[model samples]
Target chain A: MHLTFYTIWPCALFNINRMQSISSSSYAVHFNQRAYDALNGHLSEKSYSKIFIVVDENTHEHCLAPFMGRIQGTYDFEIIELESGEENKNIDTCTQVWNVLSELDGDRKSLMINLGGGVITDLGGFVASTFKRGIDFINVPTTLLSMVDASVGGKTGVDLGPLKNQIGVINQPEMVLIVTDFLKTLEERQLQSGFAEMLKHGLIQNAGYWEELKEVSHFKLMDDLIYESVQIKNKVVLEDPTEQDLRKILNYGHTLGHAIESYFLENVEKKALLHGEAIAVGMVLEGYLSKDLVGLPEAQLADIKNTFLGRYPKVDFTEDDIKAILALLKFDKKNSHGNINFVLLKSIGDPVIDIQVPDELYKKAFAYYAEN
Target chain B: MHLTFYTIWPCALFNINRMQSISSSSYAVHFNQRAYDALNGHLSEKSYSKIFIVVDENTHEHCLAPFMGRIQGTYDFEIIELESGEENKNIDTCTQVWNVLSELDGDRKSLMINLGGGVITDLGGFVASTFKRGIDFINVPTTLLSMVDASVGGKTGVDLGPLKNQIGVINQPEMVLIVTDFLKTLEERQLQSGFAEMLKHGLIQNAGYWEELKEVSHFKLMDDLIYESVQIKNKVVLEDPTEQDLRKILNYGHTLGHAIESYFLENVEKKALLHGEAIAVGMVLEGYLSKDLVGLPEAQLADIKNTFLGRYPKVDFTEDDIKAILALLKFDKKNSHGNINFVLLKSIGDPVIDIQVPDELYKKAFAYYAEN
Candidate 1:
């Protein structure tokens, strides 16, 4: 199946024709220009008994209308709207979606289209996977973060209380459509939050990609950059679907980054940080640890700190905050037998997995971030 | 790895040596005598970070002590007990289990042993499969129903409200250990509930087995009978893991049986029926439908009715009850595009799928069942 999507540049100055589409053996990841046409073509190739589109509030208002207008075929479909936030990604939302599917007489042959950011794709993919022991689902990620990170991987789940992704399963979708145009609807903070993941894809695997990302001064959603990030993540996931060995490298900054994200999210007195913001701090701190423990060059560590700190404002973590974050680290998913394993960078694009960082190193790493 | 277990029959007079163990490519289904020893040997071969045994209150009191005493290795293990019933098989219970695992530092390397009936295996399998995006789990089914039915099939899930298995995923455990000795602790009715599934295996695929089952009078726990049932189910499941075509035959009477089970369970005034008991009624009714729709021999249909009716008590359904049960049939997992599909038998050993039974035929089948 093939589809051609027209790109309307915001400036209206240059109508440059660019095709952004990447295909792995199992599925294809389509960018904004071809997303609608690709979806339309895919739908036409197969017959679905019922069509259910799941979207959060943000996408329902901003992305749905334009997406529906571009479709070529007339088919019966229903729209299921969810509250737009990370807080709503839980069992309750899954129950609601499951109930809606049941009430609407959705069956094994039904097709579910997840049409939003990470929360929608994660929760919707999970719901689809578990409903009647799984159903066919497609991902139309509407944020830069989801396009670059969530959409590529089959990681689908909801958080258990303060812990993020504590209950989930890895099940791939039939296809993933990455629409970079949706970034136009996001706030600067949200857009930047997504950029952090793109930056991470480069940091963990490709030095040239990391250098190109460093040159991205202004926050612009480029199809090529998003495509490159998807390729990096997809490659890692394909090589290690179960996170046995090679996949651990993808969790480079996620160890402490996730703890920090959960800490800020759960602490009422502290300002909650977007996933990217929390992980940006994580990358900086882990970079310091890498320099000390993994023989990473001090110059490269300083460069990492400068690049992240320039984009993400530093948080003033009190001693109590540090203790709480450290405690939360014990619950990190990467840990096995209570040993906190960190994926530290050996260089800008190289990562070493299962490295145990001492508490003293953790304290010193925090101190370095504070001093910087 | 192999281990031999000596069966100490509850009645010393029946000390017959019975070898009841079956192996598939990935796992084994061991009968009472060999179950514990097999489990011990399997555990010894693997090194786990921690061991968590999940059981219901019934199993904790009646089975846990015996199960623990049989183990030879010294390993740190925790007991997680939940209320025993179908009512507790929901997402809330899953959350409690996940919380316990997280609190106890259960990691990807940790192993979970499910030691109860279908409820324990279904919910525990789901928890292990989704925890940290999946973990290793073993099923030690301690009830006849679980041994003959739930133990062999990889289907794991919880009901969504009144719907049966509306939310779940299909994930196989590392191994499944079935001990028929647990049947000694069950009430007569509970043991009979399991017999219905054994009867189903015969009716769907083996006429000779059906004839042998009809000859049995007492509610005795026979390891050979259990083994045969497990072999039948395992063979069916292995052929069609995803229930694409051949597997639907496994749902023989489950189409209406599940709806009836859900209706009775949800209604406060109505008495809930055990899964096998409800399905026994379903098989009788569907037997009549089969004779009418698929040209099954009238003599065989009569034989099926006589065997089941003689064994299982009839459930009186009011017209309103029938309507509610019919409404619930629309939510059957085997359904596609809102069509209610039934797996009906053309003969004692022959099964057909996707047969659309007319509403009038359904009424007549119920009438035939009532008259019998």
Candidate 2:
């Protein structure tokens, strides 16, 4: 293995916290050093039928060459490149992968390495999960959002029409490899989009981390900060890998975030919000909602709003548009028996799972955001 | 629970030898006694979010009333009836069911009961398996072939274009409740179709049973025989739930059976081969192939051929027709690579799985049958 020196330690040493255990299978998230060591060991395992790499057009151009270069001759493998976009993540693409793998005589013993952002990790993991009932796969996350959020959870799937993640299976990969090097090729807007999730991660779990995050805003700092943000998410996912309870904490910004994403996707002429962009907006509005549910200090709420507004200048929402977004919230996949349940924060750092906000309270919450 | 009397209990209670032990999530074929006793269980204990019964317009007219009366107060549910016949078991119908199910708020926890013949069982099970990742379902098979074949294996899916079971998942149902009483309303041709699989069960696993089967032709006697056939399948499935090895024995006649079934379905003027009817022809032809593979006495092979031809008359096959049928053999979903594998019999009661048959052999096998 021709390993490049990313960190000072020629042979990097690291430890991982085993916080989450899944019922169906087990998986590990290699923080730094362990992740690098795992690469050699995985390639040496002689029992696999074949190794497969799933990438997108963008990742194939930027990430695949460097990623494969590290372990070039260690294993025999093949590659499948999918169209690069969230719009292509559906059953049609899944069928295409299934057909290709079947034609290649892929069997259950094969391993899949998903080397891209959230789209590749999600769609590739999903394809491996359903192929021949299930197969082993690894997530090599290249984006900050996928590293901190998507890669840790076992949720793998694609969207259906206007619905997000409407079709999917909750199957964890065998391991996840988070290498910061891929971030170098990420576009500036993509880098900014991913940082919003990191900010939300700090806000939901660690008050100390939230305080530490008051540092100056630049996408460059993500490298030094990704480890801590991943830990916060890793802790919650470990507690509830299936999103039955504690995992709901991760949905702090996603409730409204998804609605805004869906709304803008339909209204294509309007500028589309990256998943993280919508969540940034979600955190601001939900902060006001949190103030009503539990007494978050006025200073903290204002700080949350001003911090995000400073990075992402406010996108105006008319009353009608706000109503349409609110209507979409009812269709949220998490809702039970057609009732909208919001994940509200008790404080900037702590979140309470499965709190049902009254319809009247939702109306009030939206009006507060509109007036503010 | 309604207690029912059985003529044979300890005498007919044959344990499936291949299954080491039953798993909690195992697909159970509740033959004679167990199927009748399950009516008393509450719907809440069934682990389904909602219960859906899939019936055909014909079954709605003929068999729905009697079956609904049995499990009426046990659960509050709705019936989804589709158009009758093998012709409608395509992707178009599956899409319609998906649309209806999406609007009904059907999620993973919902249960689908296939309450008619093979078409309902196959298509309904397909719909349930693909709906919202997958849902729990049951098979209350009213037809003979479905009760013995479709209900036993978890291969649920719909046909794609001209291909059968092209889009599907191999997910087991919670239970299979085979009520033979509903067979009273089945047309004679449908009953004959179901009988084909029963003969296959006898031919592949029990020479003694196969000998005894030659004497029985009545519906009442067929019910007892169907239970035995289900036991054979249940035992094989329990051993290899995913069709890796021993389960291939179940495909005794299906290779040629499917080709003939598809051929009949495509031709309008020609009478369609009921699943069993096609298999009857397949059994006769494969019986000849078995003669070549194993040293079967000429008398035994002749007896098997005469019995099938006597029961279900042969359909003429021209050289060109045989070539087309042979080409369709390549599309079997069980095939991974380009190789065409067959489950050939070593003896009347023993099937050898994964026998690689050359393309030349298919031509010879067809030529032998075409002349016969």
What's the CA error at residue A60 for candidate 1, in Å? 0.7
lDDT by residue for model 1 (B246-271), tens: 98998888998999999999998988
Q: Candidate 1 local accuracy as lDDT?
A: 0.85
Docking class of 1: medium
Q: Tell me how each candidate scores on DockQ against the true complex.
A: 0.77, 0.20
Residue B273, model 2: Cα distance from true site in angstroms: 3.1
Give per-residue CA lDDT, model 2, range B1-372, as digits (tens): 011111211222222222221222365566443554453353535555556778888788887666555552344366788888888986568667766665665655567778888788878876776565566678788888888888777777666555666655577777787766678888887887788888898888999888888877676756557767777887888788877789888888788878878887887877777888888888877777777776656677778887787788678877777877887776665564455567778778888877776566666666655565
Give the chain B TM-score achieved by candidate 1: 0.94
Give the CAPRI rating of model 2. Answer: incorrect
Taking all chains together, each candidate's TM-score versus the true structure is: 0.94, 0.83
Q: Score candidate 2 by lDDT.
A: 0.73
Best by DockQ: 1
User: What DockQ would you assign to candidate 2?
Assistant: 0.20
